[model samples]
Target: MAEQLEPETILREISDLEGRIEELRQAANMPVPDLRATLDAALVELELALTALRTMGVDQANAAGRSATAETERRVLRTVFQDAPVPLFLLDRDAGVRRVNKQAAAMLGTSPGYVSGKQFIAFCDLPARAALRSQLAAVVRTGRRRRTEVRFLGREHPVDAMVTMARVWIRGEPDPMIVVAAGATAVPDGPADDERPTRTATPAAGTAGGAAREAAPLSDDRDDEVMAALVHRMDVLATASELLLDEPVFNENVAVRRCARLLTAEMTEWVFIDLTPPRAGPASAGGTGAPGAAGHEANGDLRRVVVMGQPDEHGEETVHSLEQLAPEPGTLPHTVFTTRQSALRPHVEDLDLLGVCADGQPACVKMGATSVLCVPVEDGDRCIGTITLASRGEHGPLDLLDLGVAQRLGRLLALVIRASRLYQRRDEIAVSLQASLLPQRLPQIPGVEVAGLYRAATHGIEVGGDFYDVFPAAGGGWGMVLGDVCGKGQEAAAVTAAARHGVRALSGWKSDPAEVLSMVNQALLDEERFVTAVMAGLTVGGEGMKATLASAGHPPAIVIRPDGMVRYASSGGVPLGLFEDFEVGTQVIELAAGDTLFLHSDGVLDACDMSRRQFGQERLLEVLAGHAAAPLQEMLNAVEQRLIDYCDGDLRDDVSMLAVRRQPTPLN
Candidate 1:
């Protein structure tokens, strides 16, 4: 600027001046030289072409830095998209593919190079294209993620796909929509776009579609309903379990009835169970007909048949034979009879096949059942029976789970049945033992009318412990004894026999009741076992009947005069086996003519009612008073009836009574 110079030289000088000013401004706080000043200075060198060089150099440097940054960013993005497993794509403002990764290309059955610049709809199959359009538009407007499933048409087949949408921003422009896709096969039936967003669909009214699908709002709302049903099933099973363990109600028939009722209620249908033996005749002969008029053969192998659901018009119950239900020779019912086990027939023309059909006919024109399931009821290792469940109307046949439950139920029923039979056998054995041990008839004694009664306990199979004896005494009087042992069964019966023999042997030694009991006590103590007993000796004299009674831990005897007056002979002593020094206590009472004396074992007072309340001594005494003046047998019968009534028909202990009456001297 200080000298007149050539154009190039002038431009160089101006440039130098501008650089100095800028550097000074950086060192200080002054503003840089203005662009206008530089331009005006450069114009002075317009004839030299120096202005062009300075301007071009600055512009070139700026472009090079920007190009380097853009290249680095593009390289990083390409690597990220290529390695990602999920299908990824970038779309331009016009919803055209700007970039597509390998995953997306493979899904669409095309390459990235071919896919780029193509409209997103052009890549999708017809059904999915419409859906993608709707999803992208919604994503673009809302700036939120949207998702759907679609089917992409491949070169040779179609692939299921899951599409996701969200907004993405590019440099120097508003954010445009981006779409990512995945693939799945578990979609419900519809067009290829079943899971894909429809072309005209609006944005869903909530958060991301992924959140809604994962949580499944409708399914969550119905959870309680499903759980309630599960709880009800569990409750029913628990109730059945309780009933099975209840000894009082564990009857076979009762269990069967309950199980049938439960099944009927649960399935909402009629149920029929026929416990019958297997057929030995030809299948055609035994077909769907009433069992032969003759009762089942005594020697015939018997099997149980339990049929659930109502039979056809001909009334054929769902029948399954034991042999058909068994798995192998020795196996549990549930394990052997699986759900897949079935008896099959090709046509309904055969009688055996017809018998199984719902119509109970051998007509071939009718629609025949495809399969039938039979579950065997096994007890231990032997197949006792079969449980048959049927499918009717339009419902599919039973599966493994259904048959499994039935087999389990059959096993439970078998247990109940076996237990009941065992209980009955035990009861029979107990009654037989008691009858064999006790005296069936009483011996006639001089000057005395005696009647005796013995009743076994009704609780279970157990030989009774009650016993009574009427024999001659030393002084020509009758010795009567009644006593109860402490327990039941063979052991108690053995002790009872010992006690009776000891009393009879002692009667020969002395007439006094106390001396007789002393002898009996010594005899019982001599043996290993103990006994409780009451003994009475009555001698007929000129004036009246004189009686001496002794009790060893035995209840007192009751005497009823012919005049309707009642009295109790109270005598007590320690039970047998208490000590070697123990003694029998005695009480003497004169019986007027026609007086009757009653002696009984403690079992009479220990009887229990249905409510578990005992028929105490007070109740027995009152009963004896009411029947005081009746005939001996009538009095015994009346007492029996009253006892049974008071106990509400439940006798938990044995009862025995011996009655002795002094007849009026025949009025001689």
Candidate 2:
């Protein structure tokens, strides 16, 4: 039975037990008996228990003190944040608005509660939102403050502000919250904020907004005079550019003179245009022909285009045919041409004036010229020509505006000149290619009247890939071939030639239309090009003409009867070069006296008008029905004329057509 005792009682008993044990051990003189070890261990255990109880009491007191202190601090922080004057926002890691102070909500034109959980960037002006979001993200990562001036506001005129971002820790969050604060807002380029731009109106600084304050007045009368001169120069340049660019660009020399004449009479007393030939390289940006190549090919050599002078007494400009002189180095005109830049001799009153004009001499001495501006005519990277403008007494020294206008005129002149050259070259090639490739003559189909007409596209000058041929085949009958390659240029041309000759070679003595087309298709497969074709074998006799037609992705042919009945002969198959071995279907048509057979390429129905509406197959049938009784030649003419009217001369593709009609039995 253990004694139940209070702490004081236990201590007394343990003290008495210890004294008894020690006394017994001393009487027995047994080296202070082993009972002391057990008593000492018990004493240590009792001391540990007392220390834990005292520590628990101290911890309870400190917890209560800390809770009161934390509550007071939280209340103080909330009060300060709620009353702050400037706009403020508390943002979470994603920049979501966790809290917004009253001023911030009002400034943003929204209620505080409504803004919670919304993105902070949404309140900023559209143009300023991007920068604001970047700055906010940076502050969150670095845990530092950042500031930037950008536009703000959702609906009204954008308000410019110096936005500040700070990282701060809020209660219950492990990471710091971003505090978005802003300084006073101001309008950009307004009366209050001189640095901001006004909308649309270009100011002295070339911004959208006007100056913050009114701009300082122009310095003096000379500035006013300069403006007046610039106004007059701009008007002349604009008129000249419009006139030169109107309609088709004329001769290069004529174009240069048009520009020269304006500045000669109004701005400069004399204008000297010396055209250096285009560099003999691969090709100018404006052309595809080699130098000296026929058509628009520039001669690839330098020459003087024009030298015109304006005498004070003479009202109009006079063309000068003076002998060309060797130009010395370092002259204004030579320097501009060599450097591909412009040269201005502001006050050439006493400056050496030999190389300023073409032929290494003063151009308008008779006009009493004292100033000169020389600008190089540049086409892309190469300097192609030089424009020399000499100022006489009446016109004052050239200003920046005058020089700028001259530089611009020089560039426009260069472009038009190069374009004109290319246009000429393209025309010559079109005529030559047409003459060589198209059939020169077609044989008469014994008892039938046959005729075909072809027209090139109205787009850019490109060779037509549309081709046709009528040749005698075996059995005294004739076979006709018509088709269009997929694209234009030399590639399509090669395929066109192959299809024509292939049909003739395979149809030596009345061959199958499908077999002829299959052989041609095999030859074209390796080229990776597509072709649409229609091959017809026709035999004319006393009864009428029998025709066998095969198509490879081409439009079906049409037959018109004497009574105005229209019918289509459709043979559908994949286009040539698509599959190595594919079946081609054929349509056999029986033609009677007074019946007209029509074959055509897609270009006929695919012709596009200015409005881009296609001259569709339905409309073509209507035209054919109307001219059903007309002669074969007349019918072809009518179809061509109707197509022209529908397309308004704005052709989108090449058109090819063939019409054959059996002559009616003599006066039945």
Candidate 3:
């Protein structure tokens, strides 16, 4: 028989065995053969010694009786848990549901399997989630039982309940488990916490209405706090809405930056707005052609567009650094975008959650992030980007209320982004269409240096109606047309195209400038749009160039002689498309060597400054006369620069100009 050892002696042997095992574990780094085998043998010996100590001097009947008692205790505990009067839940350290008793499952209106592994706080009302989360965290941090009032959201109406959480320690488990028991509390007839007013009046003691009001309890301080928070959130949203809609011209850069700043002011310490780039071509599935509703496509990455934080001396530098660091895979922002879900970490354990910064440091650590929240910027069912909020020093960790506000704000921002991209696409198309309608390269006249310039209005997004062309006509002559349609946008673009192409086609059949203008007017009569134009037919000669000029209610063409002499051609008839019988004014002009004929739209004379003073025809004449000897292209550029300076670059209309200079005949 084995010698029976005292209890103290057995405990001392166990302690010695533990010390030996620790020493062996520490020696694992050494270059020893069969180290794993030696460790396994030692563990087996420890287990056998423990068994011997338990059985030492104990009869088989007594050991069996102890085992039976342990079994009965476990069964009793299991039965109490499943049939407990109140709902009971078992949760892991992270608040993940490990198990739920039958009563708990029934209270949550779900089966145990369905509720397992889900966050317990997710079953609470949105406004209560943050508070409940804080309570659970307190219970874990202090290892003390905690109780809080929460509104569970699974029933027809929100059920008010009191939840109590206590830590349970089980052998062989590294961390304590959380046991949460919930009991139904009184359901108030008043509004919910979020809807309650900031201040509630106490009813008079004797009046009937007062007594009835007192029957239902007034809101407590917690409800008032929630109401204030809701008010603040609504105020922020109102300001954001105004910021989005207040500008007539939505500058996407300004809007995005402003929204980020707004959130930093009221929501969290740091704000990051990232966007998936707009896909080229038509929008993909579920796309609505509503202005800028082009769906954004994600290719596993997001572009950070806005970075906002507390304003300080190093704020700009910090922003620049963060902007340079795009969120990487596994980072909070990128994870949110990819998963199309919101992520709220009340305490940031992962340092690289925000990705690495330009200084080769974890972004979250560099920003001193205590909490982080990331939500998708969604367009309908598609996620276009993400908005990430971080709480740093002096700012408490973010909660579920912040998450709710951010999600709503994200939806608003998505719409703004869509509109911005839509207008951007429209501007691009306008530029391309405007380029396509004009002559790419001017046809070279025999003795003439020809140049043209067109400028769209700075105030609007629509394509201007200004058009110009310098094309080779029949009979070795050149036909030049500079015109302005009455309106802007696609409608005016159609008229401008018809008038430009019509003039080119008409000049092919008619050699006289007046005849070509008349034919163009006849075609445009049915277009329901008016056009003002000056057409010139030029022929090279030994002396210089012969120009036949015809005007259809257009600005007079100015003739600048080599000696600074300025002459304006006669004003013409009504604007084209107004009357079929109107006659265009025709003038024959002789361009001596070094002479220039300058034709311009009314926009040149109508350009205005801050004082609303126009840079009129007199200024135009002065510029032309001053630079008359310059190269034709150089002179036109000087005129445009002078106009820009006069108006401070604020153009109210489209400016179009065509200059034809007869160069001196070559001395061969």
lDDT (Cα, tens digit) per residue for candidate 2, span 79-99: 767666566678886678899
The 10-residue segment of model 1 with minimum total lDDT is 197-206
Better of 2 and 3 by TM-score: 3
> What TM-scores do the predictions have?
0.53, 0.51, 0.66
Q: Order candidates by TM-score, high to low.
A: 3, 1, 2
Better candidate by TM-score, 1 or 3: 3
From the highest lDDT down, the ranking of the candidates is: 3, 2, 1
- Candidate 1 residue runs with Cα over 4 Å from true position: 1-236, 267-300, 303-372, 391-396, 456-460, 472-477, 505-512, 526-529, 540-545, 606-615, 650-652, 665-668
TM-score of the candidate numbered 3?
Answer: 0.66
CA-RMSD of model 3: 12.2
Clashing pairs in 2: 188-196, 188-197, 189-196, 197-209, 198-208, 198-209, 295-425, 296-421, 296-425, 474-509
Candidate 3 C-alpha error for residue 259, in Å: 1.6
- Candidate 1, residue 316: the lDDT equals 37
Q: Give lDDT tens digits, candidate 1, residues 1-668.
A: 11134466446545744543432232122112233323432333342234334443332235456456546645655577666656677886456888876666654434568668767654443323323554464455335576666554432134556676666554444334465645454322322432211111111111111222211243542455346434644555666666665667346667776777766555323333434343333331222333333222222233333434443343332233222332232222222233223232111112232232233322111122222345555454334455544332122223344454566666776667656655555565667767765667787865667898887765667788778888877866778888877788788777778888778877886888777777666666755556778888878776478888889888889888776677788968866754678788788888876788998877778777777778887787777777777788888877788889988777777888889887766755
Q: Tell me, what's the RMSD of every candidate?
A: 30.4, 34.5, 12.2
Q: Flag the better candidate by TM-score, 1 or 2.
A: 1
Question: Which prediction has more favorable lDDT, 1 or 2?
Answer: 2
